[model samples]
Target chain A: MRLLLVEDELEMAAALGAALGRYDMILDHAPTLDHAMAALANHVHDGIILDRQLPDGDGLSLIPRVRALKSGIPVIVLTARGAVDERVRGLDMGADDYLAKPFAVEELLARIRALMRRSPDIAPITARIGNLVFDFDGRQASVNGRILDLPRRELLVLEALARRQGRTVQRSTLEESVYGYDDEIQSNSLDAHVSRLRRKLSETGAGVEIHSIRGVGYLLRPSL
Target chain B: MRLLLVEDELEMAAALGAALGRYDMILDHAPTLDHAMAALANHVHDGIILDRQLPDGDGLSLIPRVRALKSGIPVIVLTARGAVDERVRGLDMGADDYLAKPFAVEELLARIRALMRRSPDIAPITARIGNLVFDFDGRQASVNGRILDLPRRELLVLEALARRQGRTVQRSTLEESVYGYDDEIQSNSLDAHVSRLRRKLSETGAGVEIHSIRGVGYLLRPSL
Candidate 1:
């Protein structure tokens, strides 16, 4: 996918550019809002990574301009710490999503993919993989339209994994997202959840695998 | 609207605490992430103001912990400049909203309102006043479930009022949220929008009065 990253900081900009590039996606870096606006005027980008504060001015001013021009192009605002008004205003201004600064490259990639997919429209309430359908808000999983009663923790775990379908999610991220921050997770708790879930899927003959990435994380993909 | 302020900085924390106290809400202050977690475990708070950079650890880790303990408690992360990752990670970790450092107390108060009204499972998307119901996401006013389509600006203006329900949404906040940042709104655009939407609402035979606060914003109240 083509991306435009609008950021002023040199080192962070270069690092983000390189990280996205590693995913085999083309990234165009715009150092200022003017450059970003010009890039918007010139190119067709599948996605955008916008920094809330720029050298010349506050980036919020440019949000409506991009929306006016690109209309539905996915724009993800990168906000500095504790800028709540900026985050809400950005969303109200038609940004598809908002990301805070001092973020990890992997988290950035995850948010990018999620926003890019939803920018064109609201994501379907249910996402289907193989024969399994997951209802996001309802937090239920079904196989061939049959509701599969799943545990809350497993469901949260599954939702985290499915958001990154076909891509790996790090163990730490999963632990933090699915479990409360201070929960003392047993060494094999995540593995145990995955094992139980895998068994359940296999029982229903759903041809999907929660593949282990070993030391990194796990991925949910159709059985190969 | 009781709040918990979890921040490490002594002076800034005290200032924010006093500012929030003036709003007549309880302000529980904690200096570290662990202490903050303990505070949450002890009592329920309607809203939380968390500093991302706490002495003990990163504040992003506390969101889920707090949320699990008190569902629908609006958390506004207090982020320092240049910490994009912390902001994004906080949101992805289920923070209801974020606020950057160096923000106005008024803006923070406004955000607190927005977040409180929109917290998951707390506020209904559709609000009924007399016979009229406002659908925020759909941006429409309904009379007994019959849709009343409104123009974008007017719809937003109506929502701004409806969010307050029986109370008033400050005009400044209404203007900011509707037109967004960089809106050089001249004339009585806000009032004009409110007038038109109010007329439309009355036309549907829903006896809902949009009371003008005169120099403030508008209020939505059921008319007998």
Candidate 2:
């Protein structure tokens, strides 16, 4: 997940950026509301962690603007003020969650998770194609109750395909989901992983086939 | 997840730290094999990201030591050498995964996820208590297919309780899971969240009850 953290304090931002990265969530830092607005305009984010105290104005003010720019994007207000009224005010102003300063990183993570859960776009916990059952949450795949022990890249490739089974998943989308932004994309890496995944699935009698859509993307479906 | 990253390059360590933090993964940096050993002895980590070239010795040499120290701990070797032979050598030496330098962080994360999923300790994707069903990965709870709209903190409290329904979850464990490592725990905060959660559950007719075990912790079970 990609998140925008609107925090001015460099140390705090660094600390938070490090914490959230470990969970595989990408974070973009905006030191002020103006920067935050620019970031929001340029990039799509799964959620926003807004610091109430900003150089330009209260972070709470950004909630309505965020709602205007992207309706229903989750926002969590972060402030040093732990007052109940401040939290209520932030909530009333369109914040989905309110977290006080000196909070635990775990608590912040939990809040983010909770908010993301409420999103309408969340995929089901599991998906199936033929005899293959993939547990999206557990990151495991099994066929006939036996787990398929696959290499990481292969599994990731399968995951991208499995999530959109029977539908053509564009190559760029698969690459984006499987590779980091900084990764130097190898033109053939995805293909190699997909080929290996296909071999493993067939060997395991997963009863699934992956069809490449000539220069476009790949699709997974039940084997005829 | 807490990870031990044994990398000699200062910039590389800093970049990885920042990147991994965004995902909510805690990284502990070790500049040398000695420091890495010390960290492993002192703290339990979910995995290790090993850099092949270290000041003290070749990182591959440390794999056996790591395995001896903590069996079943996943290790991923990062090296400038991407040769197939070198990759094989690293795997033979006990590295669970090997990534050539310039690899995407997303690939590393995927490898970690795949390895963790193979562990027996992974929890089910969802848990149930009476009418309340909690989706662990999605971080949402529902009562008989009706999603519960909850404030973040209250949901977190309920999550900690619900995961181990019918059993006592220690206060420290609940606090640790709910709060961050740096959070200053308020004596009454847990109580406040639990009380609010109880009220909300009752209002929603969740058919579950949270029981406090005095000084011990809390438990969730079907409401009689």
Please state the error at residue A77 of candidate 2 in Å: 2.5
DockQ values for all predictions? 0.01, 0.01
Model 1 agreement with the true structure over A1-224: per-residue lDDT tens digits: 45788888889877876786555455777889889887777655667888877899977778788778867678788887788997898888777788888888898788876664333232323344555666543456667546778776677778777655545566876775555332357788888998999999889966778877555577677776
* TM-scores computed on chain B for all candidates: 0.54, 0.56
DockQ of 2: 0.01
**Off by more than 4 A, model 1:** A1-224, B120-224
Docking class for model 2 is incorrect
TM-score of 1: 0.33
**lDDT tens digits, residue span B1-224, model 1:** 67888888889878887887888878888999888888888887888888877898888788778767776567778777557566545555556556667878876787677555433234356687898777564345668645554666876777777788899888888888898789778888778888887788888887898888888777889876
What value does the lDDT take at residue B171 in candidate 2? 91
Off by over 4 Å in 2: A9-14, A28-44, A54-57, A120-122, A136-142, A145-163, A179-204, B1-224
**Local distance difference test, candidate 2:** 0.78
